[model samples]
Target: MHDRGRGHERRPVTQHVVVRWKAGLPRGRDEPWFLMTDLERPARRISEPYARRMSIEELFRDAKTRRNGFALRAVRLKKADRIDRLLPIVTLAYILLVGHVRLARRTWTPGRWCSNNRPNECSDFTIGPALLDQARFKPAAALAAIRKATEEVGEEWG
Candidate 1:
């Protein structure tokens, strides 16, 4: 496509990508200015669904920013390499914890939705009332009984 802003005076855009925008015209409705590279068009279309899938990103943001992540300090040296090395392990651990929360809902507080607790709750060890109820019958043997029952559950269902 021909560059719509070829002669227009504006900020210099060095990147191969261009965005289409519409501005009010003096006579009537303005036309769209298509400035995007052809390659970028497919990428933008593909990213739309992926971006929609990230609606829960805020939960991850809160966990990584508010909880145990607060203590995570930046390293002065080769940080991107370190992050590349650790990202998969971190992602796997997060996936596993999400699975755990889904299975162990009785031990968690009800929040957000029909889904499980966000990973921010992983570091929190407080057992909720329902789990406590399951823990209650053991009386003075509470801790041991809860452990045994949880173990049985793991063996049986997990």
Candidate 2:
């Protein structure tokens, strides 16, 4: 490709593939997702990574949101060292919350959600709301879950 900004320098042509996907139940409204990637993979293969990205995106969203999860944006840490110290605590807490929610999900009865509005399958994005809902009624349980997750991690490490 010709780079206009670089005084007409010639560059290698990069290719992008757009995967058009309809994401929803057969009875639900069609949610179209256009996944664009430069990775040289089949259409079906490219979509898998994009699907996995939704979880990481959700984690970021939860970390940043003021009303939902730990609003890390509200923190006043100015130094890189302080921010580094804080990240592991926040990340560990987030992971434990997710682990707790996953365990909680197994016991949850059909159509008996505490915070979910749609009554649909819960994804990682939805876990923040569900965790908040449970924390309202059971603070001890949340603490216990965190301890359990810590112990599990310790076991794996040791």
Candidate 3:
């Protein structure tokens, strides 16, 4: 593969990375293969950074796929570039809704969530007022009143 740096310069390469895999349990001979061939200096350092990006990717996947949140079906973008542009906005909206729920509720589980793989499920299935108000609200306007109070506090703080 060609190595491209942040400065938009290409590097020549004549090196190979050798990796070995060994079979477990039943016992088998070790297998070795070259992962890549390169002579660029930056890639060696970038490997760790690239692996660290998986956490953010997994979060988006968990929110979109596992939690059945951030549905893109309602969006009508056609081009790949448009889809890429919309993904961040969709993710931000999902995060905002989650933040809203967490802040409104006293107890919020960070990682505990149900995996809803079905695409056609309603949004109510993933989130509802019951999620924030496990006990029935004392007054019909309690949620609305809390939201108004939060907005006033936010404005005052700003």
- Steric overlap count per candidate: 0, 0, 0
Residue-level lDDT of model 3, residues 1-158, one tens digit each, is 55788897998657756453423412232344334535454443434434346445654554555345454455668999999998787655554554445343443342223243332122332553335445333333444545665686585344
Q: What value of lDDT does candidate 2 attain over all alpha carbons?
A: 0.63
Question: What's the lDDT for all of these models?
Answer: 0.42, 0.63, 0.48
- Against the true structure, candidate 2 reaches a TM-score of 0.57
Per-residue error (Å), model 1, residue 13 = 29
**lDDT for residue 21 in candidate 1, whole number 0-100:** 34
Question: Ranking by TM-score, best first?
Answer: 2, 1, 3
Residues 1-158 of candidate 2 have per-residue lDDT tens digits of 43354677666666675655655543453565676555787776767656658756866877888866689899999999999999999876666666557556555652454343344455544564655555443546756766776686685344
Show the lowest summed lDDT stretch of 10 residues, model 1. Answer: 121-130
RMSD of each: 15.3, 6.8, 12.5
**Candidate 2 Cα misplacement greater than 4 A, ranges:** 1-18, 23-29, 36-42, 114-158
Error of 3 at 62 (Å): 5.0
